[model samples]
Target: MRTRLAAVAENFGRDLDAAYATIDRLLRRARAEGTGLIALPEACLGGYLSSLGSAEDRGTAETRRQRSGPPALALDGPELRRVQEMARDVVVVLGICEDGGTDRYNTAVALTGDGVLGVHRKVHQPLGENLSYAAGSTFEAFETPVGRIGLQICYDKAFPEAARTAALDGARIIVSISAWPGARTAAAADLAQDRWKKRFDLYDQARALENQVVWVASNQAGTFGSLRFVGSAKVVGPGGDVLADTGVDTGVAAADVDVEAELDAARRAMFNLRDRRPDVYGALVREPAHA
Candidate 1:
């Protein structure tokens, strides 16, 4: 089955109404384009952290009291329900700051008109992120209309184990949603030349090739508060080929792929999953001796 997939690179702020408007517009375009699955940037619902790594990033006491972070939303809240309604036949993957009672989680959710399909809380918290959200515990795959899919957020892409675990669990496609920003210091004037942006693109390809799974990466574009996002949304083939990309701009990268066919073709010559030597990799699951 050839499925049309799209990954978006766009800015989303604190205004819920504005976010919904953007989502509605994107959904309309996806529907018209016959997109079966679409991935939106992290915190597309309420936006990502204003800044990172410094006390000032958290702001003054008064500022923190006024607006500490993105609004925390429940998984079953009206916000997601609205997304489900907009999703209809399309499988939509997006990020949010999940309201986990006393704790908040940077979560990614996959949904359709019927309801939620799967959820993934970011397991790797970068920089000052630990100050805002709790870490997730596992990486798992779930069945969706498009195919068996896995979800990850932002910094999780840096770890090979994260994508490998999902692939081992039978995920044919992995959707990674992020609000990734450029290099914080000595930043490149052109975002396309930024080292962090290069890493973002490299990881998308490397993860896809190593795992032999289709990779869809969506990221926030433009600056938000003190951070400048590196928008490089893309769809990569199992062979590490970039099928489509939004570059360093705000747009959608769309591609049509037959999931099973692509996987079969890619794995025919080099079956990474089948030839794994798990016995020698025992240390991967063990705690660090120093820690």
Candidate 2:
């Protein structure tokens, strides 16, 4: 079946209620445009921290408290229940701060009317993110109405092993939700010209090409406190082509394609996953020299 998917690039402040309302509005827009699977920005449930402990932040104790991020919620929390209700028609993959027992995790979950399909606790931490949440241990893909889908939060996509593990586990599509920002030092007059935007686009294409899988990338947009996000949400085909994109703006980027057929076509040439490579790549697991 030819399916339509979207990656949303937008801003959501530190208000959970406001975030819910924003999601409600986006869902309506996506449904109207016939999007079947939608990927939302990281921390879309509320908002990411103003500063990930940048030197500009005040007292260490206070910065730690503030950067801890939105109020964490349980799997069956009211916020998600409301989303589950609204997700009756399409599948949604988005990020949130998860409250489980005594620990908080940087988590992403895929949901539908049938309830949660899969959940991924972000495994990689960048900058001061480790101060805020617990790291996940594994990467596994799950079956959904869309296809065998895998979830990866920001920073995880930077490591080739992350997506390769998912593709090896039978994932046909991977969604990476991020709160990525532009160059912190080189302030560009135009956000689109930011160097980080170039890196973001490169990673999305490389990951898709190497895995021969559909890639959906969503990110936060606009400025939030000290951070200015580079909104470059996009969907990449199995052959590393950008199918749709929202460059430096807050909007939904959608594309319609036969995902399985694309994957098959891409794999027919190289069979990237089928070609065994583990025996020659033990160095990947070893400690590396600092640059």
Question: Which candidate tops TM-score?
Answer: 1
Q: lDDT per model, in order? A: 0.94, 0.89
- Candidate 2: count the clashes: 0
RMSD of candidate 2 to the true fold? 1.8
lDDT of 2 by residue, 169-269 (tens): 99999999999988878678788888888888899999999999999999999989788899999999999999999998998889998998999899897
Q: Per-residue lDDT of 1-291 in model 1, one digit per residue for the tens?
A: 899999999999999999999999999999999999999999999999898886754644335424658999999999999999999999999999999987789999999999999999999998878777888999999999998999999999999999999999999999999999999999999999999999999999999999999999999999998899999999999999999999999999999999899999999999999999998999999998999
**Which has the greatest lDDT?**
1
- Which window of ten consecutive residues has the lowest lDDT sum in model 1? 57-66
TM-score per candidate, in order?
0.96, 0.95
**lDDT agreement of model 2 with the native:** 0.89
lDDT of 1: 0.94
